[model samples]
Target: MEGLHHDTIVDGEEDDSPAKKQDSPVEEELVGDVRIEDFSEKQINHSLAPEERVNLYEQMVRIRRFEERSLRSYQQGHIGGFLHLYIGQEAVAVGAVSVMGEDDHVITAYRDHGHALAVGMDMDECMAELYGKKTGCSKGKGGSMHFFAPDKNFWGGHGIVGGQTPLGLGIAYALKFNKKAGSCLCFMGDGATNQGPFYESLNLASLWNLPVVYVIENNGYSMGTAEARHSAGEPLARRGDMFDIDWSVSHGHDMYEVRHTINDALERAHNESRPSVLEIVTYRYRGHSVADPDQTYRSKEEIEEYKKSKDPINLYKEKLIAEGHLTEGSALEIDRLAKEEAEASAEFAQASPLPEPTELMDDIYWETDNPASKTSQGTMFFETP
Candidate 1:
């Protein structure tokens, strides 16, 4: 189950010339000529209740504000380590997670603030984790890259590229074994799509008919390398064809379209025990990490263009206002509240304490008497023979 399938071969590795230049037919169909202008005219589906629309907008705003504050904190030296901001990819996480139930699982890559917030992890704990306080979701041991809330079924924000793919399969298998009415959402970056584990996981998921959806948040670049420079096949979603898994590519800027597509994928996973691949075309406003100078690879004009024309928050706000679900004043109020909340969380993190020395060994092992329970000390307890 862990090994690679024959069909999992890299597209252009054999010839080493260039991958036969071609557009993915599936991507072309799924992502039609829907431009940024279409969002203004796109009617809000009646199925999406008025309250739900507000909630989606609020969640996206909250994530944006939090990431903005996190950047400030990093610059001010309050938060350390590599900081990967989820600034521009808000729609993908919020839209997709909105369709999921409490029982469903979610896991993603290092740039995970949006995923954690979208899945309902507390703002305080997430901010605290970034600040390296003991109050973090991983008790502060895991930094910006590792936010885990098993209680909320958010497995983690893994640091390794494509590492979460296999773990996602294991979760899906467990859910099916227990006959749970839920599925797993395994999210990875465009960079991760090139790794072997991604292909291997897809092979197993399709072979076993596991209840999982592998989402590639194609933000155009893996670190500093753009997708075109790194990925062999342009559309990562088509990789699923090798395993006979249903796959589609979609614009992540539009919340409604993203929500509906993910909802359908989750439905198929939960009821039919099928898996799918979703390549979400999104963007990140900042560099790969806070440390990297994003200007070297791409131009300032490119970033400004995306922020001005295709920002998820701005588009959704306009949509809500156009549909009469929200007013300009009310939308501004939401943004104000989100900013206040994010600031409060940063203050809370600054006031929180660091982990104690004794806590270093905590969560390292499980007691033999009760293997299910976590233990700080790795001590053995057995009766004499």
Candidate 2:
């Protein structure tokens, strides 16, 4: 927070005095970052009541704690095989989903524990999934990489990189075909943005004017590979332009900014009936998965920079306290509560049962002679066949 500088490059073509951002009711530009300024507590008018603010604060903390615990469990070997922690991306889910009605849909990549919690999945259930429990959200059939909540209409924690993009658009297609009012927020990573499906999906989504929010959580790295190393001149935000979709970016480290960014994206997708892009530029403190040694690509100084200065949780607390919306003692209490809740969930998850051998066939889509139901997420509706 202290060492960062913000010297804006003037757009020489536009006679730009540091290229100003477009005006909006829900977004603004904060200090030290060129991304969209969030309508933080200070910027918000008498819009949200005190109770609503309290609930929002609690949900963000819960997501933060749930992810922290997931990381710890991953380290301890309780959670196995390619666990991706949503350490820095909590606000993108919490704030986005908070503004969505019950019917809105959310789908994202493997870094999805935060989304599951934000969308009302039980902490016990989430941790149980991490522990591969039979009573888990995905019934222990799909481990950390795949979780489906039909009740929440939270489509997935898809394993294949960039694979979920089209599925989300398909969901939007279904919503439109039925002439129903709904939206799908398809979340992907910077790495997955490189895949073919990501672009193809965007083209179709934009052409059909599908109600989908294609969000790129550009954490600046694909696994240990830096963005500069993996990505071309292709700014992930501009990916939407190929398909003529609306594009925007925000400070991914701040929930306030993330919330505002998604709010705007969803608004466009809702009112305009077209796709949109929001590139949330943030950083992660842990390794790509639980297995890597986390020593090679990035330096200690980089992690320290993000954690000490740009940590999302700290940013939220500082802005709230400074605005007099959250007291110092209240912030401390919230942290205490987050720890207690996380511990309780961990214990409960530990006590949860693992999948029984007999339970294997329970959720299989193709139990009998239906060859069409091969994939877990496949549909068997009538087609041109």
Candidate 3:
């Protein structure tokens, strides 16, 4: 909370000069500070029934608990490669997904377990993916960062930064071309915003007026570099203004605020066939990946402060309890159930068989996996002659 600056660094139109040329309007709000009291009962998660709100709370708990389990697994050397834990940003994924319609889809960066769970992905499959077991969602091909459930309209946990941005644009294009009433929620971290592909995706999204909401989960530090140090422009969502795309920012810790802002963007996408940039200010408790030591860049105090004051799970849980939708006992029960589910998932991952070595080339190509569905001819891949 100390280093979080929601105000845009650049204000109004930039001074017209050869060296000082600036793009887009710069007016921005102090975001990531929206409190639970900011919204009235009628305005906050109003559409959701009491039971549904409790479910949202449960979902957040599940994500947090799952991440905690995964972190422990990573520490125990059960997980390999990169394990990007989504410990602090549960509300953003869960709240956004809660407001989505059936046709709506989701795609996000490598820190995707939360999104996966939010979209109804089972914990066993997710944990198995991390464990590189055959039962993984990707059949053990994609560790930690490559979970995919096309049936659920969840694309993937892409390892490359900003690589999923253009793919999200394609999803939007298809939805529009097919005359489907849906939008794609393309999520990325603050670090991904600096990538070239993201800007390209934004350009086309604005140009074609695709129904895609580019959700930037700005969690202060991009990897180890503080956001202020890594990015030049303040309030990264304002970049949307250059392309004439509607953009807004909000606190990611508050589920109601997350739902409100994301629903607004989704409405723009669905109704006007337009794209929007919704930067949900969030924070991560872990490093960019499990391998990186987070202490080098960010102080322990800052992380602790966020955990104590702005934890999404705790805030939502408290809100639900205050509203009489959830009692302390119910909250504890929900958390206990989440912990049990997480532990069971870990056990499932451990007991699950590792993928056989012979399956290396399997699922690599569509034609290879599904001969009946293969319409294209010719050698898709080359074998040693």
Best by lDDT: 3
Better of 2 and 3 by TM-score: 3
Best by TM-score: 3
Please, what are the lDDT tens digits per residue for candidate 1 over residues 128-228? 99998999888899999999888888999999999999999999999999989789999999889888988889999999999999998888888988766
Q: lDDT at 246 for candidate 2?
A: 75
The parts of candidate 3 lying over 4 Å away from their true place are 6-37, 40-44, 371-385
In order of TM-score, best first, we have 3, 1, 2
Span of ten consecutive residues with least summed lDDT in model 3 = 17-26
Compared with the true structure, all predictions reach lDDT values of 0.81, 0.73, 0.84
Clashes of each: 0, 2, 0
Over the stretch 101-147, how does candidate 3's per-residue lDDT look in tens digits? 98899999899999999999999999998999999998899888998
Candidate 2 accuracy as lDDT: 0.73
lDDT tens readout by residue for model 2, 226-271: 7778877545676676677777655666666566667667667677
TM-score, every prediction? 0.86, 0.86, 0.90
Instruction: Assess candidate 1 and give its lDDT.
Output: 0.81
How does residue 19 of candidate 2 score in lDDT?
18
